[model samples]
Target chain A: MQAQDLTTEVAGLSVHLLRGGEGDPAVVLHHSTGPIGWVPFHDELAQRFAVHAVDLPGYGRSDRPSWARHPRDLAILLNRALEQLEMDGVTLIGAGFGGFVAAEMAAMTDARLRSLVLVGAAGIQPAEGEILDQMVLKEEFYVQKSFRDEESFRAFYGEDETGELADLWDFSREMTARVTWRPYMFDRRLPHILATVRTPTLLVWGEEDRVIPRSCAELYARALPNAQLEIVPEAGHVAEYEQPETVARLIAEHVGSLA
Target chain B: MFISYFTERPYQDEQGEYINTLDLAKSNADYNPVLGGDLYHRYLDEKVYAEEMGFDGLVLNEHHSMPACMGGVINVEASILARITKRARIVLAGNVLPIWDDPLWLAETLAMIDVISRGRLVCGWVRGTGRESVTHNTPSPYNWERYQEAHDLIMKAWTEPGPFRWEGEHFDYRYVNPWPRPLQQPPPIWIPGSLSKATVKWAAERQFPYLMLATEHEPTKRSFEYYDACAREAGHETGSQHRGYLFKVHVDETEELAEQTARKFLQGPSNPFLEGNQGQVRGFMQNLPGMNSRTEVLPTIETWAPAVARGAQRQHKKILEKKKMAKGKDRDYSGSYEEQIAKYTIIAGTPDQVVEKIRNVLEYLRPGIIAIWDGDGAMSHEDTMRALRLLGEEVIPRVREIGKELDLHSPFEVSPVTNKPVAEAVGVG
Candidate 1:
């Protein structure tokens, strides 16, 4: 499926809503580099759930509003986008930095978030091995040090065999630059807020991931009383891109089980 | 003016044979699940230690997907260097600015570094080596033109009255002002090149320094002559005052020991194992007018190897397999200390001999500055420290003495810290 299949709008200052996918309401938030065209995984998820992918303010097609100073401001702007979409009683799936936003939404909002699924999510304060510090400060650091193999690089990037790998590579780099480009992940208080998220969560991680290490998954799984951990082998940081079928099946099953 | 070792210490594998650059880069992949943070921290630590050792400046450069040269992002190194050495000048000896989406960010980042370090920043601009720009998705047809435009934009952003608009062929901006102004009045600018007439002329027009890599002495001398005449015609003073050269140096207790050390070092496997990658270098240089001509520019491995092999066959009345082996081995010396120094493009000797040889070069070239590339081939930390000590203590002082004889002034003079001059003579501004 092409990204053109999805329609988008500015839900608030620096925030955009990509509307498509029909079923039980599922809010899909993207990582940094902004709102992208719909992926096959998003399409698959759309088959069973109404999907709403958000472009955080200052990224993607969203406006770079001056009011959005930090990640909390981003969290507030994300909440407003949900309000604009009139989205309630939804399952939230966040990837990379988007996962941080999803976790924040689950923790703070009184909205009806049925469940949370964080795929290669980044928000928890990592005490030991924090890739965020390096990723945010120096992009080349991540590019040079992250991927283990050519396959891993290609997979995490989510480029298909269509020779559009060049464009996708540029997009992946730009996305990384946009999200972690400033003050990095978010305020240190974010991990403390993770404890308040009562939503039943699924922590999905790529075994070969470098952006957010697999060890971080164990931390999140331990912190959230109701969270489950699934390790996808042979995948890097972007597990959804690498193992979309498995990720989709897992998500579908998880959401169904919640019912 | 500065010498920093490009350490390849990590290439040492289990068998003690130095691994190729490609394998070294790939080796990190094995630890991808665990050691990313440690590797990054170690990289930073190396740069920080370089500052503590008291080099005039720290150097970081960019190369992509090449194992021999792992510094893929020069800016990242610059950032780390800036944080550690708050007072020392951080020189990114020409980032391939043309490949970037916005060179203004480079200017802005440099400005921020200047502010953070209170003005100890020097910016170098370059068009980059051939074929490397392809990975950045930069248009090869317009590389030189884009480089020129990017250089101008960054300069204007740094020097011009800001909040002004900038509309250019490549960039359009309504607000041209960038925060954190550079402290050095204007941070010093240096341009590094080998055989580009356009680059030479540009540096000449601006009266900025030109850093020449070690090429054949005749062509290098001729290039400097052309640079001198051009600078003079432009009504600018010309001499070694702004001319520097980058060369590899290996010092040992004796000449024999130095050669032995170099041979052992050269025997290590080459980094960057990709096939057809060497064509990138050839394709890049072939585009430049003077460099495009095989005879005009100095011969590299591509031109030199087959010729030498053919010559050896003619001499022996048969194709000697050993000659081919030698040629292959020579090609692998792209990152070797011995090959670089033995060619006299770089200098290898005991500290005393190195000092004497450098003095000879100064007499012949009269360059204003001398930049030493001690960082190559994963040089050991201890060896690098020793080289720095010898350079700072022995070589630099001797060079200064020679400068006195030539009536050349030192480029660096102490910044007047106290207001004694204006305070006593006139009121402070």
Candidate 2:
């Protein structure tokens, strides 16, 4: 099936949704650090499952509610929007900061979610010495530590500096600032809340992830009774960007098994 | 050998506008300076364009906190290139692996790229420049040792049979196996250098390709000789068996126009040390020890300017200084344009002249492969395209003819067109 086009709404503090495919429902949440442009995982899954990718309330084309306190509030609002759209029984896929909201939504909502895919998911506070804040924030630092060679960096980020899609990142960064302005991360109770999520979970983390440590993926795996872990080789927090095909394949296989 | 073009903005006016050596550099800020989207787009086009042009291999390198050289995060470039050029051989002429305490992560990411590109990976090991190492707080004195160990460990993960224990000074691991084995058995290895003894000897012993960036004839010749001699002494084959050079290239209709453009773009009021000299020397020393010694051998800036000025008066004085300090025998930068054309070592002429020069270099070096390093000093897109179009349509065919005459295997082949539509495939594009 062809990929769906993007549509918008004003329900529960305005949200933009890109709908695609037509089968078992899958709700895709983009990272707070970027727009809700469905990553490769969601794109691949769209071939089978009916996919609903939503821009967070404050990100992409979504209207930001001034009263929205944190990502959890955004998550609650997403739950309300899902209800309005009647997209039930979704296999929720959340990456980075989006994972934080997915965890909260899983805990607070009673909606039917088939499963959950958390990629380099962020929510739990990292152990001392395991998390390196300085390395994560600086582009040079992360490039030096995460990528093995210049080619890998080029592969992760496109080689061109003057292409049409180049400026898409500017909008991404602006969206990130809007959602995660005050504190980049969420509450410390995120893991405790995630533990209550009984949805079948698949945790995929980059072995070289500096933003959220791999150990944290392990922690999430242990916390969720139905969770399984897959470590992407040679990737950072943005594994979908670096090794999209591999990540897509994994998602397809896992989601296919459930179907 | 893989060739990746690097673009740099060498000249900065007091008003903050950068003038490029090659007209192509202007594109870096042409679309939108603050947004940086245009610059990124141009880079992507270049990589895809290079692949379509039929380069045997393409390369990308890393640098940080410098405007002159803007490829701060090369992985970003590589990831995009992988999607655009699914068939071309891609080389990350290196990642400064030593700076990161955990290099395994890099190994994993490269392995993923290898998978994505279907195994066309050329691994380049580097111990970043002094300025970068200092700024990042990565140990400099032991960078070489760290780089060597990292190389050994990563290779083991890529090639060796599974899950072995790895214990080294910098990194210690109980399990050393990596998944998704690279497609090209052991991916080809190339070491970039300005002229470092340690790197030359290491590459020579292993018979890996040697890449000389921004190098001159005299020092480059000595380096080739040294590599050859070392290989011979070690009972290994050498010479052009695995040697390549990287230089800023610009080809126009006339030599005078190209030189004039180069001079106008490369000159301006930028600080020599910050803008050019120190980074060049420091990058050489840290990554290539042999180049450090060579830097001491060549003539100093004051002495070499007069000599080079006679030939190319518009040349950057600091560049001449660095060239003078380079070590190596066969110091032959003197000759009429025609005489230099006869040498064919550097391509800096019209299409025919450039083609002739490449043929001569190929004949003289007889190296297995050559990489054209065309990125430097803010070469503009228009000029780059002109050179690329000329080379693809003219220079490459002539070089193939020369290779045939010499009974050498052609380095590239045009892939046949497929019947399938691109939009239908899964990750095929």
Candidate 3:
């Protein structure tokens, strides 16, 4: 299905969301690269549930608001966005840096979110390996670290013929920095907040995810009030693009089992 | 023109191979403190001699876990300079403005320095480079906002009768009072900028003298032009007194020795003090995102002159044309030491030759205050002192005359600060 563009203004800033599919409401939160619009993973989800793939304010097509200084600030904006869009009991699925935003949203008081799914999420300071400092990583080195499926990874960016598009890819990363550059990526308060998460949550990991440490997956699963963990084998940080069928099947199963 | 002597107070020289082999992926550790202890005293001695050399100001700066400077806590260095240097204006070319969780402490420290220095303190509030974000563990995105808010709070603490409650988005203080008010009314605030429109605009709005740090002449003119536009918009007139410039320089009896002395400026004198834009950050950690803004990105692209966007465009076209040549046929950026001298990025030679190079910079840039980085890289303490002595005897005397001929005035000569009452308020600090 061709994704339809939807924009909603909050506080004089417009947020871009790519909406498609017809079923229960779901919001797909993109990684630090932000969304370049409906990848194959989102396409897979659109087959089962209505997915609102976001280019959160400050990322991609969305207006980057300076007032959104902290992770919780982005969460509050997302919550308001959900409310304004009138999508109650929506399933929030976040990936990588977007997973950090999702964690914040899920941890909030009286959150409108029905369930949560974090994919190679970055929020908790892992007790083990360090999260790769994304801002400083060169594109060539990052591509190597990002995917076990290098062929698929190259194909993803290979779509952009113009250097302009490649540079535009960095803007999302810039927005991610604005959102999560400080305290590195994890909010110290997040572990406590995750403990208070009122809804069930899902933590998914790529077996070979090189960007965020695997220990982070274990940390999230242990911290959340009601959460389960899933590791997709032979995949990297962008697990969906890597193992789209496996990742999408897991999400579908989680959504089906959502009480 | 207001002349100051500045140095990064580089650590004891070490083999560059350690840094070259070291993985930036793992990051760098702090320089050995044992070595720092010796270098600190030697640098302090250099500043003490600079005042005696008739420099109008003595400058210092700070960085953390970085090999370039031992000024991790610059206020401490400023305190030392304040006590030792008598006449020269002790300018801290900024306390990395945002890193301070408490600007009140900064207010107190600068206030004390002002009293100690006898009203000779030019507080340069700066938004430090992006590397500071990693080293200091401060937020990178809000660096500008924090710098602005922190400056506002500190200014209030200094000028406004404080003990007043203050609240802002970044900072909140109840009973905002600072004891030992500054010896200079609000102390002269100068801002050193790398290349940011926001900073130029902010500096202009407050009439704060904007100092461009070791930048090319054409870009300095463009930045000053930007500042002038902003100042005019803010309903003020801007001139040389409203701007400042800093550059590395060395002078000896002859051109050969001076040229050799200036080699430290290449690839920078130290490893980590290496400029971020020149392939350093990209080579190491492109993953560390969000420190750069649109303005920060444009400056390197635009070159020394924002107004010369067309010139930059032409330059880029030429570079592209060169790139299209057979792989080995392109321009080699690694020019000879003679080329660097001709570029005027570093001023070196006998006193007369140095003066001529400086005059070219002065005519082109038109900064109100010019800071001489007399020491950089492997420049020894004795050599720095020698440079200072030459400036005192030959360079400064001629520069002052040139300043007169050009109608250039230092900030002190132009903007009248309320230092008298502030001085009187501090009876005997």
Candidate 4:
């Protein structure tokens, strides 16, 4: 299935998303590195479910809502977008920075959210380790760190000789800097607020996830009332990006069980 | 001409083994307070001595989380200078506006400095480098907007009879009143810039003296001309008094001694921001997203607009020049000593040679105000004092003579704010 590029207005913002697949709806919110088109994972997930890969405001081709300054603001906007798109009974999956936004949405309203899957999400502060500051490291090095193994990283990003990928990464990082600069990626009150969210949650973590600490997934599991933590070995921060087939199998099982 | 003494007041120490300049601010492990305290006192002493040596202004600037400049909070140093220095304008060139969440404090503190200095304050504002946004945790995207708002807020807080509420987009206050207002009625405002055309235009529109930091001579001239054009468009007459030039210059009794001492400017921790340090360009930190819109990388020299350049022609030229820069040629200053001398970015010689070099700059740029940047990097206290002595006793007198011959009058001689002679403005010939 070929992913079709589409745009939907959410609270006056032109949100860019890629739509492909069949069956139940699974909305994919991109990581802080920004959306890099529909990848192999999106295709795999598309086989079982209708995957909607979204570029959050200030990211990709989406019209940036200049007024929005926090993940919570993005969450409210996304919830409104889902409502506008008439997407109910949705399985919301978010990775990295997007995961933070997804968790916020789930906490705010479970109206359209049927199930939640957070992969190495950054919202709740980790007890043991800190979220790696993206600004401190070079864009190329930072993206490379996202995967556990060399082959996994090269497979997804390829050898970027032209610095085009680096430019995209920088553009995305700017958006990340805009919203998440002050308190960084985590919300102080998110842990408490997330406890009240009754949405069935599945927390996925790359065993070697270096960006957002692996302990963050454990924290998210603790925060959510109905959530289970699954640690995938030989994977990094974006486990879905690295081990797509395994992550897709896990998501399929989680969503299938929910149905 | 209004001449000032300037320095980064750098902490002289060996750089860490693991860190580059981009990482130096956060990752540098080689910082000692004992050395820092001594250096701070030493810098203050140099400023005091610069005033004693007859510098018209004692210029100080601010930077954060970096060893390049220990003047983390310039107002703090300015307050101390206010008490110590009897004369010489406390030229803040200047405070980083965007990082200050509460500019009310800035207003109050500056007001106090003016009060203490008995009105010898030339206030300046800068949109700080991207490192500031990162270290201070300010939103980089809103840096320019915040800088503008903060500038407007501060101006209003100073000029307008207060207790008036300020409801700005970035900042707001219920009570916009501060005690002990600045003695200089709104104080003489100056804007210093290197490359950003927006800043140069903004300064020109306000009729503020646009102090050009160490830029290539040709670009500096072009920038001044651009400022002139901008000022003209704003319906103001501009002269040399409306522009200023700052460059690294050292004078000693002997040429060899001068060059040796001046070479110390490149001795400190590698600073990406400093021209001579030539640190690796960490594009992400330097070119923060919204902070710089033109390109998402290091601005190449020649392609990058100088302290001066103007209009649609300049823009077209820049576009062509930028294409050249994109090819990864002449990316930045090499920070080599020979290159520094060749580009005239650094001038180090005997009193005669230094004066001659100063004349060349004066003739080229025709700036009313000139800031002799010295005492930076690892130059010792003695070296700085000797250089100041030569500057005050020899170079300054010659420059003053040239200033008259070349018709260069500083803001004091000719008010930049009014475009009228200061004597006329004050009703005294």
Candidate 5:
């Protein structure tokens, strides 16, 4: 199913969005590298739910929120965007930096969210290892490290030698740097704040994820009042991108349980 | 012309074997601070002698987490110069502004230096490289904004009656006052640049002298022309006083000796700043996410500008090309060294020959201040002293005469800040 492009105005700022499929509403907040339009994960989710993929403020075609200096700030803006769209009781699926935003939003207020799914999220600091610093690593290398292996990454991005997508990647990284500098990907207060969140949260992690470590999953599980950790084997950071079918099934199961 | 002596104060001990793969800025497994202490003293001694030799100014700069420039905490050395040197202007060309968490401390320190030196301080500022952001952990994206804000904060602290509050985009302070304001009101503020047109335009608009840091002759000229146009647009009459050039020139009794000693520019610590130095900087580390994106110009490290990005790509490309050429062997890229010499990146000759070359540069750029960047890489103390002596006795006098002939007056002669003569300068101060 092809996604239809939509532009939603949230408090004078234009937010780029993609809508597809049918049934209950599910908002897909993309990673820091920005939105990947209608991927296998989105397509699979779209089979049962109306998938609404959004490019957070300062990413993709969305207007930059100049005052934004942290993921919590973006979380506030995303909350407003969801409120403006009138998206209530929706499954909020966030990946990478977007997951941090998702957690922050949930912590702030979960009135808009029915259930929350965070894949390879970066909010709570991992106790064992680091959330790979994308700032220092080369852009290509950073992209490569996000997948399970070479074949999986290549199957998705395929050499990318033309550098045609470099500007988009750079813009997204700029947004990431603006928001996630100093404390890096994780928020120090997020774990404590998340204890107040009552939303049914499903924390997804790739067993072989090299970006945000698996320990972060345990930390997230411990932080949320109502949360479950699901580890997908034979996948990396963005397991939804690598093993889309499995991730979709897990999400479906979780949502079904919530119903 | 205001002739100043400068150096990167290279550590002079990094082994040649690790030049290709290891980025010395990030790793310090081979660093020895014991020897570093000795080298520091040696560089300080050279600066003192530079003053004794009659150089109008002594230029100093700061770089972090790198052996290429040993002046990581240059204000300490500047303070030392303020005490030891009695004649020369202690030009900090300058402190890396954006990385400083509290610019007030810098304002206070510089004020103390100026008062101590009796108004012989030419306070300059640098935006610094991406490596600075990584090493200092200063946000790279806000590097330029922080630089501007820090500058504004420092300037206000220096000139205005403070105890005022400052709330900026990057910095927020409730109490914004520093004691001991500078003797020269605000000192002679200079903005040195190379490739970034945005910086040149900014400096020109403010009528601050923009010193081109060891850039090629034609590009430097074009930059000055751009500055002139910008100055005109900003309703200011522009000349040499608004322009300066940092050129690498070594003078000796014989041409061969001068060239040989100056050729050591690439022989010391492997520096990414110097061409054909067999040094390698990681592309990602140098071009950290927000380092260049803030600026309007191209983001490479060529032309060695303090501003964001452009020339770095060329340097990285050279390293990669060297990798390709030395695929099976341990050969070096000798072509870049020859190219540097041909391009006058490193000009070295007999006193007369060097003077003639300076005349050519004077005729070409007509910069009021020509800072001689020497005493760097692995050159011996004796060689550096001799070069300084030749520069002070033979080169500077001739250049001063040429300066008058060409009507090239420095910001000291005609202040770029106030457009008034600095009543007392150099030795008088």
Candidate 6:
């Protein structure tokens, strides 16, 4: 399944959207390192639900409005875009830093969101260890540490030279700094507001994840009143990007249960 | 001609080993408190002396996580200089605008300096270099925007009457009423740039004296001309007062002694990290992706592309050309220091010889203001004191004569010191 590029305006800023799949809308919110093209995980989920992979403001080709300076601002902007797109009953899946943004939207909005799936997410600060600040880490090292498959690491490094990929790397880092630099990644008030998110949540984790500790996943599971935890074996922080088939299988089952 | 004193306050100790410039976290092992303490105090003493030497101003700049200078907060030093120096403009060339989360503090602090200095504060705003971006982790693209907003906010806080709310793009303040406001009304604002057309044109448009830092004769002329063209386009003709040049110059009683002292600049010791900065973790961290737009980065790319690419052609000369010293090809100044002096990068000789070199530089660049650096790297404090002695007793006064003959109007001469009121309560002239 091939995904097509799209652009939409929200709050006077241009949003870069890549749409594919069919059926109900499944929004894929990417990590801090902004998503450019569709990944394998999107394709796997596309079989059941239409996927709308968005480049968050200041990430990928999207124009970063000056006012989107906080995580809440990003949440508001994303929700505005979805509302303009007339998307309803959408299954929201967010990965890494995107998870932080996703959790905020889930807390505030009720009518549009059907379910929430957080993968190796970052929102709750864990007791044992905090999420690793990825700004200082080299690109190749980040990809290597985030993946369980050695081939996946090698393939990512092999093709990173193209100019577009380099720009995405920069956008992701800058936007991350804009929203997450001060409080680190997690919103301090999120845990108290978790109960507001009426939709069921599924927390997916990479068993070998090191970027954000597995402790965060357990924290999310404990905090959310209606949530389940599923840790995939031999995967890291980017569990979906590393093991898309396994993550998709869990997400698909979760969607079925929700329906 | 406006003569000023500048230094990076090097942490001169041989015990510490070289570390990577980019990875500042891991690279901080080189610092020794004993050395740092001695250096910071001495820099203050040097500023006091610069004021005593009848120099028009003292230039204090900001840099982070570098062993070469301890000026992480320039205003702290400026505040001290306010109380200490009786005369001489406290020229901050200048505070890095993007790093400060609260520009209100900056407005208040500079106001305090202006009050204490009895209305002698020349504020210079700079975007800072790439090293600063990574060290502070400020977004590169916003360097321009933040600098603009921060500048506007400070100006508003100073000029706009009590308690006006500011809702700028980068900064939002409910109330901006700085107590103990600046004495100089709108203190003389200066900006330093290389070949950056944006900065040069901005300075021209705003009527700020654009100070060119150690750029070669040709590039400096082109930049000056560009500023002139900008001023003309904006409906005013620019003069010598619009241009200022800074040089790393050394003067002693003997030629050999002068060359030895002046040659340290080629070392590019400015990086703080003894190792090269390119492609390193800090380099990537500072440069990130959008920190600088292509247009913003073009001038730098044009300047350093060939030298960085033709690395093989770089000879054993430790000291590279100033043009090659921007960001990419930070060539370590090595080899025949005498040869580099001949390249005219560093003006070194007897007092008479140094005067001739200064005249040549002034003629080629024709700047109304000139800042000189007499210390860095291995150059000792005594060497700096001696260099200053020659500059004050001999170089500065002579330059004044030459400047008069050349009609190089200082910023003071072009726009005479007319008191700009901070508030209506302060009584406007």
The runs of at least 3 residues in candidate 3 whose Cα sits more than 4 Å from the true structure, single-residue gaps closed, are A9-14, A83-89, A108-115, A139-144, A159-161, A164-166, A193-200, A257-259, B14-30, B267-292, B295-301, B304-335, B416-429
| Candidate maximizing TM-score | 5
**Candidate 6 chain A: 10-residue stretch with minimal lDDT:** A156-165
Better of 1 and 3 by DockQ: 3
- The residue-by-residue lDDT of candidate 3 on B62-113, one tens digit each, is 7665555678888898898888877889888888888788888889999999
After aligning candidate 1 to the native by TM-score, how far in Å is the CA of A31 from where it should be?
A: 41
Which lDDT tens digits does candidate 6 get at residues A23-43? 888999998877848888889
Where model 1 places Cα greater than 4 Å from the true spot, the runs are A1-259, B1-54, B253-257, B264-342, B408-429
Cα-based TM-score, every candidate: 0.51, 0.49, 0.87, 0.93, 0.94, 0.87
> Tens digit of lDDT per residue, candidate 1, span B113-180?
77777777777887765335534655444556678888888888888878888787667778888887
- Poorest 10 consecutive residues of model 2 chain B by lDDT? B410-419
TM-score of chain A of each: 0.81, 0.82, 0.94, 0.97, 0.98, 0.94
Question: lDDT values of the candidates?
Answer: 0.59, 0.59, 0.74, 0.82, 0.81, 0.74
Please provide, for model 6 over B285-379, each residue's C-alpha lDDT reduced to its tens digit, 9 standing for 90 to 100. Answer: 54444444434321323333212211211211112333444333343232345544665657788889988988998888888899886776567
Model 1 is docked with a DockQ of 0.01
Which runs of model 4 end up more than 4 angstroms from their true locations? B13-22, B25-30, B279-281, B296-300, B303-322, B325-333, B427-429
TM-score of 5: 0.94
Candidate 5 scores a C-alpha RMSD against the true structure in Å of: 4.1
Q: Compute DockQ for each candidate against the true complex.
A: 0.01, 0.01, 0.57, 0.57, 0.77, 0.33
Over A170-191, each residue of candidate 3 has an lDDT whose tens digit, in order, gives: 5665666676777778988889
What's the CA error at residue A20 for candidate 4, in Å?
A: 0.7
Regions of model 6 farther than 4 Å from truth: A5-16, A22-24, A84-86, A138-145, A148-151, B18-23, B26-34, B129-141, B172-175, B195-197, B266-281, B288-290, B297-301, B305-343, B416-429
Q: Which whole-number lDDT from 0 to 100 does residue A70 have in model 2?
A: 64
lDDT of 5 by residue, B1-429 (tens): 898999989877745433443453446777787878988999999999898888899999888877778888889999999999998999988888989998889899999999999999998888777667778888877877888899888889888997999998777889877878889777878987665567777788888898888767776787788888989899888878898899888888897798788888877776666655636666566666666543344222223322212224533344345445432123323325576777777788998888888888889889899899988777889989899888878888888999999989898787675665657444333
